[model samples]
Target: MLSFNIYLYCGGNISMKMAFRPTDGWRWYFDREYDSLMLEVSSDMLFRSCYPSKMLIPDVFSEFSFSVSDAASYYQFHNCCHSLNLTESQKIQLSINGIVAANFLKPQMPKSWYFSQQSTEYTPKVADIVKVYMQEDGLEVCMMVVEVGEHASLCIIAQPTFFSMNKTFYFSEAIKVMNDRLALAQQFAQPDNSIVLDDEELELKAIS
Candidate 1:
């Protein structure tokens, strides 16, 4: 399992610390100035940072609640996951409510001129929208990802609802609300930067 630390800052001061383990997904941590958040997945692990707010961590993981004061912190955790190169299984587990859909289109490869080989190799590119949902403490969290080519954008919408009101609120109403929230989140979302891992570090971590 991979393990790493996530640090979030507010007004230039550390606001929160998050611990992420491949086996446990992400957890809240309070330690100060620990080791870097990097772990080996296959041959190496990569780290990079972008507009943190673009990836909403709180919505993806149920362990943390969304709050205005610590909003950036949540993004920081999401950035850490990107840096750590989380696996598909890890991501699905983090979506505690279970993934609604994860559809992807296969990217076609160009044919090589050297040989008469049919380009049978294709990479699965995640679709523009990837959604996950979870219900907790009288609220429902919806996490969605909008991908453009190789770039991915994230959004999280939390809505308040009660089991008692289920009869009163139409399912379509809930979907509309979720859709509205998603549109709003998209306005502030940005594309993520690519982070390449170091094979040497990955080997060391794997052995350690």
Candidate 2:
């Protein structure tokens, strides 16, 4: 069986640990620096799906590697699978066959999104606009916020292909936007109505 050393950050320090190996399924690894946990499914397992299967992996995961951001995201993802009572191999099959559903496991916003849910004041409203800075490419993307629930919000990027594209932003940068909005809200002591993306702001480019 293939194995991988998973590294997690605790108290600002990194520690390595071996992921659990079941009789079948993928290997999971937590690479904290990337703020995402990686899942590697074997080619043989993927081949089990016949042609025209919905189990299509994105080009980004050409190496059969998939990832979910943060522990909460992973927890939400696993819960969504209804695999808590299923065997390891069953869980793998569920994930493979339910690629579209698995996408919802990812956090819509940053961890602060959850924290803000506990406080009504910080909860994002529908049509709330926020700026996102993509550190990897130094591009800024504008997100129109929609409240998912008391604990989360959906950030829809403003782009022509936004609905069909897979776009991601750094959690840290999202937190910064939340902080800026909160500061503004506190200073104004009113329902801040800043939902417009600056015309001067640069538009985000598609990844090649």
Candidate 3:
């Protein structure tokens, strides 16, 4: 059961108000709030960003929520089940409600590629944003490892789409939030429809 609702992440408590103003005509955005990542769109369901991909990281990307991989790392994630031995953290999918920094989860793959302790494949391109996977664990089931107020090296995590935090909140603080949001997102997702916010789709290649 894969859960994907990020709004539900922080305890399924944080509520999002619908301030969307889809107006008539207004074929293009008149302006945007750079500081808050607020956007204005037109009649199109597909709104393209004027900002380059390089300019979006940690800010706009955090708001929109996306990660991608090149050929090498793509293979690495797919082959991880066979080739590499990962630390405990790398083995699970995390819903972060905190901060992040340079080399977020460094010495590991880039933040764009999420590593699942289970055999989850990395998508092949940055254009594929909506990925569907099943969450093996129900949103209600999660094992807690760290305690609240305890400080550990911040692990790099990518929230689907909302905001990218600077790596501040504690692990214990995030547990209930992530689980609840996962259930709500139902794709982080729920057992039948896990929703991973990746930029690419899985293209499996026969390993050598």
lDDT of 1 by residue, 27-131 (tens): 322111232212111122222111122222323222232233233333332342342233432322222211111111122221111112212322222221222
TM-score of each: 0.18, 0.22, 0.20
What clash count does candidate 3 reach? 37
Ranking by lDDT: 2, 1, 3
lDDT of 3: 0.22
Q: How much lDDT does each candidate structure score?
A: 0.23, 0.30, 0.22
Ranking by TM-score: 2, 3, 1
Tens-place lDDT digits, model 2, residues 116-138: 21222455554344443343332
Worst 10 residues of 1 by lDDT: 96-105
Residue 20 in model 2: shift from native, Å?
Answer: 54
Mark the regions of model 3 whose C-alpha exceeds 4 Å error after superposition. 1-24, 27-38, 41-109, 112-117, 120-208
For candidate 2, list the clashing residue pairs, or say none: none
* After superposition, candidate 1 runs with Cα above 4 Å error: 1-18, 23-94, 98-182, 186-208
Q: Residue 38 CA error for candidate 3 (Å)?
A: 5.0
